[model samples]
Target: MATDHDIPSPCPSLRDRKKAATRAAILDHAERLFEERGYDQVTGAEIADAANISVKTLFVYFRSKEDLAFADTWLIDAVVDTLSRRPSGTSHAQAVGEVLNQALRTLNPDSGGLDAFHRGFGESEALRSRLLRMWADYEDAIATVLAREASLPAPDPAIRLAATQLIGIIRSCTSDEVREYVSGFPGEETDALRGWIRQAVEQVDNGLTRFLDRTSQSPGI
Candidate 1:
């Protein structure tokens, strides 16, 4: 006696599921090979062979070796989606903070693969540069979404600034703590990190408001 709305949608088709498995296999082999040998030492063809896919097929899944190296662009997309879905009354800073809190909850500090991924970053300058570029792209994507929410044009400076500030908190929370945890050192707990994220967001939100107010109240030039 369920309505159409109450029924679950169909799962992905078999062909689509197979494609996803193939893509995951390629990424898994690529990451393992990169971690075992440095990123510069690993070749895309070798990764394809390891994954049982042809080089051409590998290229169909990812644009370049660098794309396979990070292979976590979905993380950025998830954040942007979370922001886009925030409640109407929520501020951008609060939305970002909540999304990051959810992200921290998913971290597995004891995962050896996480440790290896962090090590891989330090072993290759190219990998580090690619990561930075990916983050910059993510900031822009988030800014575009925020602009839409505000009914402003894309690339609005204020929206972009807010996006960067919000993403900076996320980067600091993940990069610093993950590196420390992966380094076999004492690292902040998830709860503690969440507290810090909230504090940083509030500071940025209030500081910006205060600065704008002061500027507006000052004598005109």
Candidate 2:
């Protein structure tokens, strides 16, 4: 007899498929328009028209134009999920690296998706502000995970600093400056960037491990 766990899950319903397709179409049209012109120049209504959807429907899919442009909530959730369930022996940095590596592999560097984002970032204060808020959220999430794993009363300075440093490394690597510089390379050089980021993370991991060991052995932790 087949157990509950042995049975395959049901596929998505037609409504779910249509909703997902609509969302994807909105993103596709929005990105293309943003890239061709500038993010600031493209209106949400224009995006809706381009996607062959009503402006009202566009709002249903995405709350705002900024929301449409910076839609990576899945990545944030994935990071938290991975950190929460990582093996006992795996370092926090290692778990983060695993998620990042998978994301990088799936990314198409030549797609120019990030071009508009970076350009808008440089041109618009709103974008720069949004970017900072996004990074802060990532830092806070990391710090929370670190605190939870350590069973700390709260996120201490060391834990917060370590989380900041890890996110900083990621932010620096993905900065508009690095992207422009890497654009000159023969290929996308994703491997080179990935290797460099890994080394940085590993170094931080080693330092964090040593610090934790020392603090744990001290009279007052």
Highest lDDT among the candidates is held by which one?
Answer: 2
Best by TM-score: 2
Q: State each model's CA lDDT, in order.
A: 0.71, 0.74
On residues 1-221, what C-alpha lDDT tens digit does candidate 2 reach at each position? Answer: 99999999999999999999999999888878877888888898899999999999999988878877777576668778988898988877787777777777676775432232344323666777777888899999988987887788678777788788767666766676667665665575676567656886787787777444524645442
Cα lDDT of candidate 1 equals 0.71
User: Which pairs in model 1 have colliding backbones?
Assistant: none
Q: In model 1, which range of ten residues has the least summed lDDT?
A: 212-221
Error of 2 at 132 (Å): 0.9
lDDT of 2: 0.74
**In order, what is each prediction's RMSD in angstroms?**
4.9, 4.0
Model 2 C-alpha RMSD vs. true structure (Å) is: 4.0
* lDDT score at residue 212, model 2, on the 0-100 scale: 47
Collision count for each candidate, in order: 0, 0
